[model samples]
Target chain A: MPVPAHHPVDILRFNTCGSVDDGKSTLIGRLLYDSKNLMEDQIEALERSADITGGGQINLANLTDGLRAEREQGITIDVAYRYFATPKRKFIVADTPGHVQYTRNMVTGASISNLSVVLVDARQGVIEQSRRHTCIASLLRIPHLAIAVNKMDLVDWSEERFIEIRDQFEEFLPRLDMKDVKFIPLSALTGDNVVEPSSKTPWFTGPTLLGHLESVHIGSDWNLNGFRLPVQWVNRPNNPTDPRLHDFRGFSGQIAGGIVKAGQKVMVLPSGLISRVKEIWTYDGPVPEAFCPQSITLLLEDDIDVSRGDMIIGPDNLPGQSTELHAKVCWMHQRPLQRGRKYFLKHTTQTVQAVVTEIEDRINVSTFEPEPDAPELALNDIGEIRLKTAKPLIFDGYAINRLTGSFILIEQGTHATVAAGMLFPPTEAVKPEYTDFSI
Target chain B: MNSYHLDHLQYLETDAIHVMREVAAEFERPAILFSGGKDSICLLRLAEKAFRPSDIPMPLLNIETGHEFPELIGFRDRRAKELGAKLIVRTVEDVLARGLATAAPGEVSRNRLQIPALLGAIEEFRFDCCVGGARRDEEKARAKERFFSFRDSFGQWDPKNQRPEIWNLYNARLNAGENMRVFPLSNWTEVDVWEYVRKEKLEVPGIYFSHERECFRRGGQWLPIPPPHAGAGQPDPYAGARPKPAEKHAKLVVRVRTIADMISTGMIESRADSVDDIIAEIAAARVTERGTRADDKSSEAAMEDRKKAGYF
Candidate 1:
């Protein structure tokens, strides 16, 4: 077959998570191998490793276990990113470890993923680890989910066994806010339903796993409602020789939400100053309009006192601005997170001093229950906390816009990043009663 | 479908540009580690796009191993001149002469010698951040690396103790004597690089295309044959002076998949002469780009060990 010609296609980012014995690594290896993404040299290297393979069988798990310790221990240590492409779409797969101790790593992987693939062993259906991964995926507000009922061959490829496992997931999936879910029965080791339709499952008429991945509707992934631009830098080319750029000044940043057009009215936060966009400058010169995720330089009509760490928004759907923030945090440090601990909160383009004022509760991953008033959050712990920052943070709920709602905390003395957080909806919108309030 | 949509290439370009601008804004002193390779060629274009109609805020830094191809060196100088950016050239020979780094006896390749030269340049210039062209798709250990990789005072990497990078919001804080090695191309692949090259109409070194050269077969690899001698009493720049006894010499038409030191860089037999052909060839080729580099083939963890010791 001839290689597909290069054509424009959208990208899809997803992650795979499961228990240690559910064959997550093998499933990923099978996907890449069957897709013809693995090069011959890589395959040769895998086959040449005698110490890791036995009985003349190539252990597919060796492909994603990148670290020496991980290989020696026969487990994945951290998240490893793998890339492959079909003619329909390009895929970036974040292969995460399944160890319960590495829940923080899974969270890190899921934070940027659009879809989450939760692997399940058909022999042991719907275990605690499977539920925990699915719950976390739902909590991260991932738009899509796939429950791969792996090792179906171990159960003789029985339709009854597949339906039984799907029923187990259905009991708890409705409680979660997941909208799109797919279930597939396949054997990762035998290469059954991952890429090709298996003859064993004559009753299974749905698309194969690869077909589902390729045809998933991901066009409405990004938030395109409220315009938000956090000023990253002040582009000032104080050129004396060039006549066109003698006094050029613009605000440079990537659009976090919504669309921005030239001559549109915008409001700068904290100052309540409104201005019209004079020109939108991109890499290919001035453009008439741009949308979410496009990096551009905007020239405002007025010489407003806007600088880095400030936000520019459109005239409608104003984001909430408050000093007290309620957020869900995934603690990643050895030091237990407690009240009265100060950290530097980095949100959007600004970093401000923030202190943990209240520890509300912790979410038990195994049972998916809330433990109220947890004393402290330990490593790889997910909990809700209230914080008070030195300055007001303009943001939306994470469910609305993941870009403007996420943050990370840096410890005061050690300067280590200790937590990843998603903000709740602000209680008030910086005094909405006043039409033109300035702080 | 709505009209507001960005293709994969556009998305990658936007992300890369944002990273470059972030480095410019956050770091006190920064530089671009330019190697004049295909990846670095993309880096320079992104830098231009990030801060254009004005001079680039950071200077270009190159650690010449003294065994580099002359064609690449010429192209590097000419490109920097065209952009009007300052190019800082530091040589491994200078590092050896200053007693800053020592090479093993009869060591012909300077692959290991580049570490000290790079660290020395970072210290001498007080560069807080250095933008690199490393991509995660290059190696296994690199696949686990962060976009803003932190380095200690001695420039060592502890893969197990890395910071938790959540999203595009990167943590760039550092203490004294500490710095960062930022990769804007962490998510791109080899095919993406070639396709972007074709789309942008950028010029690369001629060594990338197929050419006729005197070569030999050694250790199952096709290597270019070194010249007879140094004219006008200049020292020999190539690593190998003579072929081994078992080496079979021949004249072959080949192209380099990756550009490293001339001695360690291997050539593959190909008839591709254009960017489109190269992309198509890569799509159907069996061997990986890094499979041709002799330095990475020393062991399974060679790239990991070198990266841990602060080698770019």
Candidate 2:
């Protein structure tokens, strides 16, 4: 086969979240329009819909507010994804709703985003909605954040006002534990500082919002500390036609963390069984080594008992294995999450019955404070809770590796996913009692 | 080698492959919803890479509208035969024959009938999951769908009540009589499809390329002029929709951007014969891919309505 002529470009997945009045949709519309991502037909559609706005200007929000109710109400109700690619990179933007009642949607969008853009209306500076979104991004451990101080024209493109808004975020951003934060002032409606730098912001020396998004170094976003592979399936071709695959039994999964190579020694969790990697097989072919996020099939030297839900890891770094888990979750269902309610906790490849042992406290999003002894976690509520699982869950803290650190709650009988959770780091690491098998 | 980075195509490929493998390992009986369109052609290629060196684990399922382009049907059969994968075709004619669905008089497109045809196949085979080639960028409502979209026993989609998909983890749990529609191409766009098709060197039907055909204009879209004696047997589903001699038909070189029933699918005039040319044309094109799809043009939420009613 001929090599693909197109050069491989890495993908960047990010999300935008803020209040309805923050002009989040307009900013996204400007980004797409100014970036030349909008097709001619789409622009025509915008013009046709422009008649409805009465201002003779296209309603940019119509691009994202797709649902009938959302468009009718002039607000985003659910998360909608938009894709656009430049020569340098491809972007997958999760345009999430800004309503305070839609915290679940934001958390769902934030789960896989490498970066997050929290828009702040320049007129309002940093408000409760800004803090709440920033708090969610921090809690989700999104590697990068861009605080787009939008509507700069309304604030006279004042450098002083921009700094004031930046200061407001700086005060709470520290408490939020954000590592990479970039603040840019822009006017979405006027198309200033979105794709190209605006002349109005001569005082601002930073790159435009699109420039930052395109140039941000996201290579180190993945947790590459220890080898973690939650085996999703066991690949056994058992093909009678080919002699090489007759007895093929390989553990298959996407490498969640770190790297693995042929002949590397590894341990299978929950079983404590040690084995050496016999081969690493990708769709292209076998390779010497593979890193995080590559889905590959591995053949082991020993035929150990490993199945779905079982995690395989390198012996160097041990993960916490326990029946009790403490996690912060954003409740999604109408039924409030209270003490002693049993639900299905799906973490990685495993799903187990878990019960809420205690609702530690609800974090008041506005104040960034943990209100202790909260009765229940109502819909859109973010709170820390304790749980006991039917089986021991093998995981790392959410701060360490998002793949191994996060889980979801599925309500029993209904099977509706009710919460998105981030697991707290293990209070104590599991002892390497099974190391004897390595010898 | 020091920098572990995947090309955009490679990332999407792996992501899709992961979802395919999940369906293989999770569902009891799974099948791919192949339509022989460009998107599904790319989907078939992804399936090849996903389970290759071994036969595809599942069968290829298609819901024929009985108004399909003959070239596409031919490609579908040949591709399935080449892959050594079983091809299951359930047609709208079968649904009509069984009196399960009725067609309106003068209805040119049997698109609505496809819902019953597809659901029947799922029931007949007891398929717990049907993998499709639907992409989010194709329509507005599609952009809000999860990778693993859940369907009730009636095959209805509830956009509001969807499972929260986190990371690469998917919730494939479903109740009895219920099935799941998993979209591996949920993140891919029309341009990506063409690009991947070029890179993979996958073969599609001839209709995707520009060709000369007799056509007429309606609703600002060029539609092929069907032969007077088309589907000459049993009842013409499009009986009253046939044009009279007074109406003008012209010969034009056109290609379909989005393939549906010939009666409903609109063709854009083009000379883009190769995938490379097609990509360049798309780059300069003014409209969305679905802008030519008459089925989606009926209402602002037509796609959403059909999807909720179990249309793929």
Candidate 3:
């Protein structure tokens, strides 16, 4: 079939995780290869490389397992991104390493992913790394989970083998809070039930990987229930040459949530005064309405006051504004996250001085349980912690809105990203103390 | 065309536009690093989309190494005029005349010298932000870069000290004299850029497409013959000396790849001559675009090392 001009397939951002030699790379490679997304040069290079296995054909795994060390050792060491497009959707595949040492890299890749593809070798069933990845995925609140029982051909493509793995995953699913979970049994190497249905697995009936990706309900993936647009910059051309731009004021940002339309009442956070959306501006042109995650310029009916680092939101359903916050953080730095350690808390467009107030507990990945009274969080550790910001921040629970509810902890001295955090339920509900404070 | 998904292209487009706006709003003086490559072409298109009906809001800066393809230079000039934006050309030859950059004895490539030329231009313009089309997926060191990457006063990028970018919140704040290298297409892949160009119907240099050229094998890859003014002491500069008599001659055939400088960039043997052919070729190929870059073949971290010294 010839390539189409306008295939408006849905978007799918997914991460892959599995134990070493569990065929994670093979799964992604098969998806891209079988889908005919691998470029001609890429295929030729793969074929020419000495790393080609016994079949004398190109190693699909080499497409994603990029690092020289990883290639030499036959493992993934860092997060590699792969892109492919089908008629139904466009996919950004985050091929994360599965080694126990590279867990931090996996967390980084999985943080932004909407779906987590957990590959389980049919023989191994469920391993520690598989559980660890699923826990991390659940902790990150990925809405969808697909347990790909790979190497089915190795296990004789037996339906019993697939069921055995599925049953094991089911026992652990109730322990975590995943909204939608699916199980697919297929051999990524042989291209069974990936983009196409497998006649071999007639005993087990389910949608193909491609079918699931295309038909999945992703419109509800974004948090459209709450209105949040953190102002990245205040657009005031103030150029007299273009009189139209003279006194043309607009706050530009990607909407974090909710529907924003012309004439909708909105409030600028930190300064509680209310205003109306005069227009929603985009690169193409002005639109009557805009929604979450769409980068846009909003012209206010009344230019009462606004600037970068401020957030514009619906006055009725405003985010929780407080200086203290309790959140689940995935510590990413080698340096431990200790109480009283000062870091920059970057939430939306605002960065403010912040300190770790307390470490409630660190969740053990292997067992998917929390260990109480952990003093500090080391690298690749997930924990619930309380933080005190130098200034107030307006945010919602991460479950409700991924954009507004997420933040990063920047090391004060080096400015490195130390942790990825998801705001939990506020520990204290306190009213905003109105005061004129400037940085 | 029927299987094209707009969401992926649209997402990449939106992300690039957002980064452009951030550079405009955050920096005092900004410029787009126009290399006349596919990536930079995509960046120029994104900039047009970002602030159209009002110029690009910044100048298009090209640090000419004097080793660029002639076709590329012509395309760059014409495209700049088409967009009605200022095109600022800085040359290493000028830096050489001023003694700011000096080539080593018997050196053929001025790529190493480009660092000084680029830094000199940044200082001359007092630009706080320089928008580029670098993608993180291109290299390992780039994988650690933020959308709004910070550079020291000397224009050095310390990958280990990059700011954490979370949930699209970019921290563009920097001290005076320090500049930021903004990569709006940091998230885009090579295929994504081509698909975008096809989708947007963007015009790029003809050299990008498959074309017949006088080329020979050198350092395990193909290199184009230097232009007449390229100072020839080097016979078969396209092909390094080999044992076979037939290998001494240059091969005139269509080439697929055109990554960086014509002198250093290797060409892949190909029959695909159009965008559709190139796309089909790419869809079936396993080799990366960087596979043909002779400079990168020098070492594993050649791109990273250059990047640290402020070679954008």
Candidate 4:
């Protein structure tokens, strides 16, 4: 219906996270600088303010630290986003701070990313914050994990040190469920192997960090199995002049998972009514098919009563519909989450009133242990909790479909998003008795 | 039929449509902040994709500072009519006349004064969400704004306490007076906007391209020379809605990169007469898109100061 540009480079949303001194901001600054994405005014601003924030040289970190206080303190207080591109792929980097108190920021920034770059100083090795960032990325289910062992030059470009840090990650990575992991040695400050190949690393034979990032196989990252479309709204353009707008009723939503064909049979959730997909309409025209993550309007064969917050799914692979939800949550508000507190629960297109029923266990990030008897979860605390909703929610486990599986909790009066929750089955954690269990 | 991948523009279009639909479904009453600028023009096209077949589900909202270019105003009214949507205008002159807002002494720019008029309009209409075309790459302060930025009852933005927007789930729940400033173009940059415009063959105002205008130089930028002779000392050229200055104006070859209020917007001497020419000029231009904005050049944190007072 309009002009169309046919460049198919997928946009990769990723984030760079590490400790305060681990050069997370510097890495982002380097990525933007090396790509020459900084406009003249921004560069001039940097040069003008160099004397104030930097110790002589132009501080690349000054580009990302937006607030005055952040510039004054020489730290990142909030999650900042930066975008750059290569011919192979367009990139969006969420530069999240690594403060222990701001784990909520990390969780939120990493939630929508396809990959995560966890930086560690070569001299300091893997610290608590390193494990914390890795664990958060794993919990967020980022498909690809890139552990950048930065400051290789500071360690005389030692392969042994890089392998040692990689070994530490190998021991800790098994506990999480990340499929693709890459270990790269570089220096975020000295520009070694970051965007260019360093001459000192003759022993190393891998692509530069930018090259690897541009070539990562992320096409299969999205789940394309079960068809799930949470109906966002109804498109009824009752335009009298245009025939297409005459009695044009369509179910509109972004496809959360799987593939949908024009004539496929589908079921409306919460109400077990079945119907066939009459047509799939895109802005371009009526396409024969559409896939996951594309926004489109659907015309059903039958005029069933479907509205916002309703679910449209395939009959073969059904999701669990329940009023009670057991979830792993990352608390964000200063007011600790407690039992009997009613909050607004938002999942995909649906929002309902839900209350905390029980606190199963608070996860200690450093030790990877569960404090099962904790009374309440404080800010930035990750815990397993039980929630009871006033209405049934159709959702898959977070392990299957991230879009349908995750939800957020909003404070009732303030409307601030207090926690991010991932849904799972409320199964008993009782270990069955096993005598002489062998592998 | 199996083309699963979308170009960057198509993906951005899909994203904007999703956000628009979400606002329409979640908020009780929503309005789109239309400035008749290129970004807002893209927003209008996105609305068409989102809820068309029917009239746009929301009204077009604009805060007039009484200092807009005549071409911009003409384009704004015509586009609104063409789309069959109600156009709501809140003027700063009316607010000043009613003594609802006061300007600092010698404050020639009415950019800050428009905030109160806009907030007044939101309150009078009881709008829950006001969608805007603000992008993150415009300035440093705007870079931190989320897609669903929350505002207090006073219509003030607390950059420190913004809600974390994860995935596409926007929290649009608001109290009676507290509204949300939704930015669907948060991820789009200036280059992306131009590419989309060229791709969609969207019609923009004549001022964006090379045009002839009578103007004077101020702060190294071309300002439309106020109609007749201003006899020294009596030069409040933008004072009131005086009859469209009608004196024979010595016109110059100038074009503006942004279609803001005429007094605050700057013009450049260029021969870029077509969309392709404009795109090529932008590709080679060294200055940032907002570098020529007189209002933003007033202070380093000018945008931040205005946004705290609910400036879209």
Interface RMSD of the candidates, in order? 1.8, 3.7, 4.8, 4.4
lDDT of 4 by residue, B203-248 (tens): 9999898988777666666676534535578656465412234423
Report the C-alpha lDDT of model 2 over A44-124, residue by residue, as the tens digit. 767877876636778888888778888778888778999987877899999988998777888878788989999999889
* Interface DockQ of each model: 0.66, 0.52, 0.30, 0.44
- Candidate 4 residue lDDT tens string, A337-430: 9999999999989999999999999988777778897899999888999999999898888888899889999999888899988888424321
Of 3 and 4, the candidate ahead on DockQ is 4
Error of 2 at A108 (Å): 1.3
Which sequence of candidate numbers ranks them by DockQ, best first? 1, 2, 4, 3
Fnat, 2 decimals, each candidate? 0.62, 0.53, 0.29, 0.52
lDDT of 3 by residue, A58-167 (tens): 67787776555556688877677777777677777778778876777787677778799998999989988889899989988998998888888888889888888899
Clashing pairs in 2: A40-B286, A41-B286, A41-B287
Reference-based TM-score, model 4: 0.92
Error of 2 at B32 (Å): 1.3
In angstroms, the error of model 4 at A184 is 2.1
| Pairs with backbone N, CA or C atoms under 3 Å apart (clashes), candidate 1 | none
DockQ, candidate no. 3: 0.30
Cα lDDT listed for each candidate: 0.88, 0.87, 0.78, 0.83
Candidate number that wins on TM-score, 3 or 4: 4
The DockQ for candidate 4, computed on C-alphas, is: 0.44
- For residue B145, give model 3's deviation from the true position in Å: 6.3
Which window of ten consecutive residues has the lowest lDDT sum in model 1 chain A? Answer: A430-439
Residues B257-311, candidate 1: write the lDDT tens digits: 9999678889898888888779888989888899998888988888889989998
